[model samples]
Target chain A: MNEVLLPGVGLRYEFDTAEGNRIGIVARRDGRFEVVDYDRRDPDRSRLLLRLTEEEADAVAEILGAPRIAERFADLTREVPGLSAGQVEVAADSRYVDRPLGETRARTRTGASIVAIVRGEAVIASPSPVEVLRAKDVLVVIGTPDGIAGVDRIIHAP
Target chain B: MHTSVALLLELGLILTALSALGALARRFALTPVPLYLLAGLALGEGGIAPVPAADEFVEIGAAIGVVLLLLTLGLEFSLGEFAASARRHVRSAVVDLVLNATPGAVVGWLVGLSPLGVLALAGATWVSSSGIIARLLTDLGRLGNRETPAVLSVLVLEDFAMAAYLPLLTVLAAGGSWWQAGLGVLLAVGAVAVAFVASRRWGHQIGRLLSHPEPEQLMLRVLGTTLVVAGLAELVGASAAVGAFLVGLTLTGVVADRARAVLAPLRDLFAATFFLAIGFAVDVRALLPLLPAAIALAAVTAGTKVLTGAYAASLDGVGRWGRLRAGTALIPRGEFSIVILGLAAVADPTLGALVTAYVLVLAITGPVLARLVRAPLPARSGPNVRVDRR
Candidate 1:
């Protein structure tokens, strides 16, 4: 990421993701952030524009970047001796992809509850059962090692 | 002694009533200014029961209110921001001055006011309520809109203009010989210019004096300094509010924000009293006579304010709806108008009633119009709209 100071305006941070998505975040002096997403096909044409408070921007960044949540939830890991918290990628082969959380029943069968689901740059924490999981959804689950493995099987089932 | 006790009881009851009204206004999402004014009117000479004892105290409180209002306004812009915004948006500021101020002056003239009264009316009409405008923008989620910067720049310019206009009006309204008034004006101009230079040179050092972390200490220091300076300005025949404003400009950096946090509630309390005192001075009977003229003047000035915003936004290449939104958002006039009229309250008989009626009309309409003129489509918009959606 490259950050440029636009004098008299604000600070603009621009970067390209490994997936070839272009993003630019402008942090205004008034403590607001403007996030601009460009279509990979046409870098000049913006696909989405968003204004966010600092907190919202931080939340979104945590979802997109996996290491952020690990650092943020380090205390939780330390509080539980045997328990672990990790994110699982819902790839193309995942059977529960595009299905609602209630229908998957991963919590009921494996004793591993999905605490959050991160899709793209959006974070849905303490999600309701009706929330539909989609491809590229990253599920943040908490359980014992055995439970996590069981739920991982449930999601990855083809 | 009996009258003194009566005054104490009356003041206590009036304050309690005003607090209730303030709550009600908040519940209705309305600015409590008109309500406060109405309460003042109801308690004044022509109302059901007049406040004889507490009127003097209320008058002093109202003066403090004006100083605090101007001071907080000054705190919002540092000298650098003020100077930069003025330079960049000089065109809009000029347009605003010409368009918004003329209607009041013309109306003042039509009503056969003295030259000073006309000047007071112009000052009343010229500036928009920064407090109201800022609140409405936040409420309507338009702070990130394309036209917001245009709106903000005009507001800053008006404040900058006030640095000059306020002194001019104060001197003229002080009621002295022509030479004395002229000298006062020159002296005021010199004082403001000196303050500006001092702010540029030693604003940081001044800022350090106000940087106490303890809220109580901070409040005491800030308010004490403001009142002393304000009193000195009034002693010199310039408006105390102008001195308070210059003090605000001088305290830059973190201290300005901290002072704002500490001083806001006091400002609100005193400012509400200021509005109430204006209402208190007004004869209810006089209001009916001036109602028509006030409405007519409000209608004209509203159009002109909109034009000022639209023209400036258009120059900035904002879209049609954005321009309209800019114009309508500029409508609400609040504290500043009342502060100006508050100074003129004693000088002219009909000035209070006329200004009260005029400001009430626009202050109510301004926020409603701002909410109404929002553009539905955010196409080709400025950089920030996504966060507002959530």
Candidate 2:
């Protein structure tokens, strides 16, 4: 089912759950969107996903070089261009900057790793896979959304 | 109308109120259980139509209700969650039991009941309504927070304790001897073990059935599952509510959640009836003379749980006041307490009126006590507000 994007007139994009659910906050050019998308399983944890309608120069800088590459395939199974739309969305999961490299690595595929760690005011180019995660390491990685979700899981597990 | 139709009407009155109250209470920012008991009070001798005129039949039915309630509760816990925090949960459980039981036992005696009965009362009230609180918290958007996990961990332990406590109470209520008590404890420990093992073995199959239901047969399948499982729980000397809880517990994974969503109509239907029956079935005037006793008992019960819960919260290392709020949140004596009193009256004839009064007063005023003592849980934490989303 879909909701009308406008109050009157009609611009509506019916949701497609088969594409996998997009939930949680959608921080965007407009006010953030908190949509309760369907999960085939538990519906209690309504996910919120955002879209950036505005791309001014500073906003473009925050867009991180390229759009995400994660959303293309229904599922991420093998090595593919990390620049795929789906992958780009995966990287863009967080608008926030501070994160742990280890945690980011953990969220992605166990096979996949973050080759570079970037965060506020500083950057770690080609950080080793074994590097212990510090609190403020902004992560750039190659892996599936599940893997990223896993990494998010580990960081918050304790 | 035919007798069957009349019975249906009676049943509908009870259950509809149960669902509607839950929905309404949540809508109004009040808890559902008290609304249930108030429904009970209103439906009792004084209110409108009295269904729970005596606790005997309803007592047995309530046993079944508890089983169903637990079924829902068990669904909420996960092995992954358990595995992650086992050690901390153990520490938390130990701290909570001690803190909660001391006052529970003492106050039970001070109120002129057996220490065992008081201890039972304490145990029943010790655990807060996680489902109630969790739903409220989720609605309020405070469900996922840094501190919330810590709080949830505590609740899981308390829930586990409550699960175990009901079985032990059942055995004792059924006249198990002291020696049997030891054996009963051992058996309950075994039950948990059995629940885990069974879940491991049949969990997948249960989940699968939940997912692939025939459209015409879906209703039958869901109803059968609650009844058969709850019946089995009683056969094994556990409450049916706890049994339903176990069923929900075992059927984890994506499918369980799917089943839960589909089974919503049934759960809410039965659960609402269950609450409404609790309200309408009671005899209010018979309980009126016991007002002095109930008030004293309520004061003592609330005082004990709050004080003890505060102590438990303190161990979490929050400040004096925050701990106090946590303690206060634990105060409301809801369904289980009412069920226990009803069960006790069945087990012992002389005590029915007094116990009913005890549950009545506690149920009505408990929420007021909760608000007075606890801080409002913070508003929902926006995911964007996170410092790190890794």
Candidate 3:
């Protein structure tokens, strides 16, 4: 990826795809985004494909990205016979609420890994040990069915 | 409390007229600066209507307008952007200065203006309107063009140059000796360097000091601090605009963004008043006499700006059409040129008429010419292209 600084405007990021097509995205200062394709005739000139407002861009990103994340983990779990993936919700009354993720020790106790935490509209992939767990967080766990169930019990335990 | 009914009525009417003119300008996809100036001319001493009661308010508002303009301009920048631009486009900036400034100097010499007038004119011609051109690029959807970075870099450097240029002009305009002017320049440049260092090292602290959760408090803190610093700069022979710019430079990240949002409306109001004040200062009769010279100067400088823009864009390896787009994009002269004239108008009274006419001609024409440049080939409808939204 090539990042170009448009001073007093915003940043332009350009990258070439495997298909040999060059694409550019201009992220403007005012939370606007412009997606463009470089003209084959004139490599410098960009043909604007889409203009997205901040909210629209976020929506588009989520639509394209949210499913792939879960699918990848499912595919990984499918590779092993006994492995499975499950979401363990962090309930409001859970002891870990507003506390660091490390304190749970779910991975050490049940051999299940917390791959990501979904909070509201955002996904925190590969959250660090110090990441604070909040109420209603959906933790994506990967392990055997028994391990996944054990991890869920540990998270919601009184 | 006593309120002047005449002042309220005239001020309200003037604002309404400005809004109408602004809408007209927007309909044509043009900056409202020239229209504001025209309105000011019409409402000034020798025009169709005069607002005697609002005169004092307009004058004071204009001063605040310049400060706010510079402050916001400073806020728009970051040290990283400035360094990257300066590193890459130092040569382009040099070419831009030489190509654009020489014509103005030659014209000033031909007109037999004093030394200060020549310097001021040179600066007026050298700088492009970042405000107008940035908006133009966005409006035309040319922000993704290959040459945009080159164009924007040149603008960044020019605005940075003004930090030094303004103080020198201020000292000279005040009839200071060469020694004093030199000292003022050094002091201003040093201040800029210190501002950059401060922003890098203690930006968070400064941001914490100024930023507030409440928009009203943020507005008050930023405005109050900027005005106080501007006054101090004026006291020390540096330009108040430069001082406000320094205040802007010290802020970064979220603080600058929120401050900008809160201050934007106030800046617009005052900036409109500033443009109007320039028009009010110059007699319409004087502008008519200077129109021919202004047109001639505009024609020459506009060409030079094209050359400068092309040179800058060529360095970025943009194609011929892209270079042309870049060149035409740099043609408009607006707020800063008028600010330069405002600083030096006292030195040469005729400068007001000449610059106002020059800016009026170019500000209107520059954007139109830029748009006329071959429109980007319509988005190719193919597997890769998708119209996500209107």
DockQ of each: 0.05, 0.04, 0.37
TM-score of 3: 0.86
Write candidate 3's Cα lDDT for B1-390 as tens digits: 999999999999999999999989988888999999999999995888999999999999999999999999999989999999999899999999999999999998887788899898899999999999999987777777899999999999999999989999999999999899999999999998999999989987898798777899999999999999999999999999999999999998778988999999999999999999998888998889889988999999989999999999999998899889999999999999999998999746678888899999999999998888974566566755442221
**Candidate 3 regions with alpha-carbon error over 4 angstroms:** A70-158, B375-390
For candidate 1, lDDT tens digit of each residue in B254-366? Answer: 57767887899999888887888888889999999999999999999899999998987787677777788889888888788888887776768788889999888988888
Top candidate on lDDT is: 3
Residue lDDT tens for model 2, B57-154? 45455555655566656766676566544554466567666665555556556656653577565664465556554443333343221123444566
Candidate 3: what's its TM-score on chain B? 0.97
Q: Residue A51 CA error for candidate 3 (Å)?
A: 1.2
By TM-score, how accurate is candidate 2? 0.62
Docking tier of model 2: it is: incorrect
Better structure of 1 and 3 per DockQ: 3
Q: For all candidates listed, what's the TM-score of chain B alone?
A: 0.92, 0.77, 0.97
Against the true structure, candidate 1 has what lDDT? 0.77
- For every candidate, what is the interface RMSD in angstroms? 11.5, 16.1, 5.4
Residue by residue across A61-127, what tens digits does model 1's lDDT show? 6667877775555568778898887777786435565579898888899888888888855789999
Task: Write candidate 2's Cα lDDT for A16-68 as tens digits.
Answer: 55567533322221222223332333322223223233345325545754323
Instruction: Give the CAPRI class of candidate 3.
Output: acceptable
